[model samples]
Target chain A: MIDPALGSLGAQIVLAASSDENHPPENIIDGNTETFWMSTGMFPQEFIIRFAESMKIALVTMHCYNVKTLKIEKSISDDATDFEAISEKEFEHTEGHLQTNDIPLNGTTATHLRFIVTSGYDHFVSVHRVSVE
Target chain B: MVKLRSRCLLVGDAAVGKSALSQMFRSDGAHFQKNYSMTAGVELVVKSVNIPETSDSVELYIFDSAGRETFVEACEKLWGQPSVLCLVFDVSSELSFSSCGRWLERVRAHCQGLHIPGVLVGNKSDLSSRREVETSVAQEWAQSQGLQYHETSAKEMENCEAPFLSLAQLFHALYQDRLQTIQNLA
Candidate 1:
């Protein structure tokens, strides 16, 4: 079972709303909790992850820090366009550790998944890692 | 082939030529505006400086914040754990020179007492006749504060790069010390 196989399956953040040299978007799929992709102090930040091939996804789990609301979307097309909303969550604030969440997708199949950070506990938010199973 | 990026902050009292010094260094002394407006918030400018005798370079993301007391509170949110500092003061204004301690305290407080490498700059050296802050006095204060001091004339575009270059070197030296410690641990 490739339980956390986003990075190993060749998924990458093809698009990001904000970019910081120190906290590049690639950290989201690096599968390392120590490194995270951080926002440069603004809201409505988003990043789109594209898998190498279309696959069945039963659940989407992630580790986030200071994130308040997160919305997940999926696209079946070849490109990362025309996304349909799957779920949105208001995270519980945590201190000294990340807020872990697993949103069930129920056997959804897609090539691209987009994660939108609508708001955050602080001015900036960090998405540590995301996995699909 | 080492590329490092760091956050650098410019803080001081108003009209101390912080913006002018930043522009001069960014443009390589080619552009010094005759009539410059005050910075209301934070302005970011990224520049790369190569370390001498090494292929490594540090990309300095300079956050030029407004010098006015009213705007400083809001500007702190944008600073975001600064790695280096450029404390500026006008040479002709004794009041501004005396406020250096306050500015330094604010920066250190925001950093949560981390060791931030930095340089103290006395701008407006062209106003030598009207200078109220002497080189010896400024140097002495900088030494007491554990910072190296340099004076520059932003209007005349002279000695503008010295302070920033010095800051880059200091950051590089700190990185070397950390690398050495890790190597010894290994």
Candidate 2:
């Protein structure tokens, strides 16, 4: 089965506080590794992604760059609020290519996923793509 | 000689030759990189345009932003406020041209209804055989959006300066108009 987090598979970016006309938050789920959603600036930037429907997720893979600390949260509710913590990790800095990492969810079921970028290797952090399996 | 500065936003869909056009304009047709790293974020390029037969000049801070939809929200924060807009699209791709409406709406919404002088640029004119957006159709749409339309080929450096130069002229004209109004009031 195809991952539901891919934009083509019906993942939706319900809310993004920062908006760049050229680089919208939709890039993270577009399923294109070459495209990305960049943070304009500051810490604690977050985006909410809603799946097509509630499904069990064993893992979530994110391809990003310059992200230092990432925190993932999930909710079974339809609305964006009431998120429960899933996992958080500090990424090692890498050069020349995107930092690809997977955060295991231990078979959690969620309708929405939240990614909070608490810090980054640089002033900005970009999320290229996100997938669920 | 009077000098003025304006922040000009270069916005459009990805792979529409925005970076190439900006680089060509900045380098005076002397530099066109064979390879371009997709602009991950905002790339700033400044150029001074001299008004013909006058010492007066306008300095443009061109913010060439990434065109992918996903990066737009982040890019808008970096845009701050812009003095002018240069909206671009690929003439060969109908999708790129259609996306122009969304780009313009997003920009206008960001500015909160303040009128910004802008132009619609159809890039990749060299690919005439593959063209999906015709000039008359594009011009009509641009007119409806309150913008002047121009076509360009960044690869061949064809008519690359018209859009930016037109923006500079419009800005200069506005400055002159404001100055005249003040003088007449005095």
Candidate 3:
């Protein structure tokens, strides 16, 4: 998770049960994982690079007070070498927005934007989900 | 076959020490730390404790959930299955305590009119001198809402045992009552 406003970034890796019924990995990143925290602004680029390298699968959700602050095109392109951006509307009822951009990388698709805020004066970005493939 | 125990849900605002409190009660030699960036979803930890006067041990399925506004809907879904609820807040931060009312309201609405016993936990009591919310105010609020309340610090381990222990006792009594009612019907 990356909180731009608070300038903090964290990562957790857990042993998750395999989705396949026949065979499951000894461990998977389901629920149990260690948590790490770092200042987001202090090491913005390094934070993104370190997270991408550490996990086999990575999902990135961008949050900002203003949608314009997202810089979705630049952030996604810069973070993952191989990625696809998709617009999704499934969380419309829960999020109060009809469409959000989904970024998929490392065989995992970032499905949700946990929070988004937009205003004339300030913009903030927070990433809520990331999974390693 | 392994039988899972009854579950209790812990709901609160972010950085309020819900995770730390859960670790202290469930994990030994627990240290204070904060790295939960939007609980992603619900995290479950299972711990077994022997009641003081009872021979049988109870397994607690504790769910430490995300406290972000965006996850409110997801939080609501999880609250439906809980047998009990622990509403936590940070005593040093008044905003967190105030948010408790919002959380409580949402939980009640999501429960579909079912009344589940809830306890308000004012965590981080070690920093009492720096406190923003007074104990009297919290107690009065809890009383008005008819919810049990406590002040605890997961860091200092103050009153940490009371909240969970009391809730466990309540669960035990409720379980026995239900059993008796079933027997009467039979």
Clashing pairs in 1: none
Stretches of candidate 3 above 4 Å error?
A1-133, B1-4, B34-38
The per-model DockQ list reads 0.07, 0.01, 0.01
Per-candidate total of colliding backbone pairs:
0, 14, 14
Please provide, for model 1 over A3-49, each residue's C-alpha lDDT reduced to its tens digit, 9 standing for 90 to 100. 44457767878998766565688988987766777664335789999
**Least accurate stretch of 10 residues (summed lDDT) in model 2 chain B?**
B177-186
Q: How well is candidate 1 docked (DockQ)?
A: 0.07
Model 2 CAPRI quality: incorrect
Interface RMSD of 3: 21.3
CAPRI quality level assigned to candidate 3 from its DockQ score: incorrect
- Which TM-score values does chain B get in all models? 0.98, 0.95, 0.87
TM-score of each: 0.64, 0.57, 0.54
Instruction: Write out fnat for all predictions, comma-separated.
Output: 0.00, 0.00, 0.00
What lDDT tens digits, residue by residue, belong to model 3 across residues B5-123? 34577889988888888888876536555555457578887776556776534467788888887876776666544556789999999899889888888666754454566688999
**What lDDT does candidate 2 reach at residue B66?**
96
What local lDDT does model 1 show for residue B112? Answer: 49
Model 2 Cα lDDT, one tens digit per residue, B1-186: 556566788999999999999999999899887786688789999998887776767788899999987888899998865668999999999999999999998888755454678999999999999999999999999999999999999899999999999888876665565434322322
Query: Can you write out model 1's per-residue Cα lDDT over B1-186, one digit (the tens) per residue?
Result: 445556789999999999999999999999898897999999998888888898777778899999998899999999876778999999999999999999999999866456888899999999989999999999999999999999999999889999988888887777565433322322
- The worst-scoring run of ten residues by lDDT in candidate 3 chain A lies at A37-46
Question: Best TM-score goes to which candidate?
Answer: 1
